[model samples]
Target: MEWIFILFLLYTLIPVWRQQRIHIARYKTIRKLESNRGSRVITLIHRQESLSFLGIPFRSFINIEDSEQILRAIRLTPDNMPIDLILHTPGGLVLASEQIAVALQKHPAKVTVFVPHYAMSGGTMICLAADEIILDENAVLGPVDPQLGRFPAASILEVIKIKELEHISDDTLIMADIARKAIQQVKTFIKQLLLPKMDEQRAEQLSEILADGRWTHDYPITGEWLKEFGLSVRFGLPKEVYLLMELYPQSPSRRPTVQYIPIPYRVENNDK
Candidate 1:
């Protein structure tokens, strides 16, 4: 029984030990990236976090707290000092996202956002406010249209348009009214972010295209597509930035579905 208890304790502590080591390594890497960039580095990474002891997973998204902390970080940055934000998220609340985006937009110095992976919805809205966006060649941004409950705001409004008023339910009519306002609000916010980067005509066009719900909410707006819109999008993410990302991993409850040799694989070109 004594031996069994000792073994059980070791099993329980191993994960905790690994967690602490990874946390320390993350802090060190963040500090190094800040030093290398000469800018205040902030990261907005929303990975599904798990309770250490319970092993229960929880989804994370941008909320008021995120806005408050990011705003504080921006406030601490010196005037005319560049800001570098490493962003990776599925996006979140319009109010929170707009608050962060406006702060980035109003900064006196250059603001750069690096997306190693995807930044969707409100994340894309925040990206638009940056002076420049650096993405991994395969990284993606998404549409900024508002979502009402489980449905897209634009889709909700469409039901009212295509159906007779007598046919439309009171609940749906109420949703349609709110949807119209939601679409308009998000469209206006996106336009404000783009105005500094392009002429009014192009900015208005791009904003409408993004917020008009022309595509599904999860559509991946590739980096190549962004350049066509004249947004300052640079490819080739920094190696250091990638290292920083490795620190914020997914919940460790399940075995990873994708795995391969971690090093570069190359075939020698032999003249035969």
Candidate 2:
């Protein structure tokens, strides 16, 4: 009985130990990356619940508090100082993302995005406004389709299809009908905002792609895809930029580097 109990404890502890080790390793890695980087890197931390701001089990939602914090951080930088934004966001509130993007655009500093992991949905939209986007080989930036609660236009189409199948009437056209409406709604919303910055035809095309487009299976989008969408993207950080900083750590030139912060996940308590 004692041996069995000991074995169970060991088994349980092993996984916990491994998790702790991984967390420590990640912390060390981030610390190393932060060290001796000449540019001012402000990390915008975001880990919000699905709907609420402080609830557990973080989901893809942007809280106003977090948005305000980000804005405040940007304001803290001295006037005329060049800064870089190393963004790593899976995307949250569309409005919040827009607010941040606008601030970046208005800032005296140049805006650049560095994606070491994944930036999807609103993340990709934010990258669009950037002066340059730096993507690692493993990094992925994808689909900017806005979702209402949990329903994208595609999901709304699925729901309409189910309703039509159940009703079995002229209502069979409902799914197609709903899709059209959804597409128009998305297009209007995007056009009002993006049209001013982009060519009208290009903006419309992007809006359609975002509304009904499928999720990307490929993690990091190919350079061709980015260029096709009219984005200025580059593979890997420039060697000379890194080298220049290494040489002049004290008198380092200011450049925009968006800091990517990891979202925290909550563990469910079965006992609760």
**Which structure among the candidates has the greatest lDDT?**
1
| Clashes per model (N, Cα, C within 3 A) | 0, 8
Please write out the lDDT profile of model 1 over residues 190-221, one tens digit for every residue.
Answer: 88888888999998999999999999999999
Q: After superposition, how far is residue 20 of candidate 1 from its true place, in Å?
A: 2.3
Q: lDDT at 154 for candidate 1?
A: 88
For the record, the alpha-carbon RMSD of candidate 1 to the native fold, in angstroms, is 1.8
TM-score result, candidate 2: 0.56
lDDT of each: 0.90, 0.58
**Could you tell me how far off, in angstroms, the CA of residue 192 lies in candidate 1 after the best superposition?**
0.8
Positional deviation of residue 222's Cα in model 1 after best superposition, in angstroms = 1.2
Superposed Cα deviation of residue 144, candidate 2 (Å): 1.9
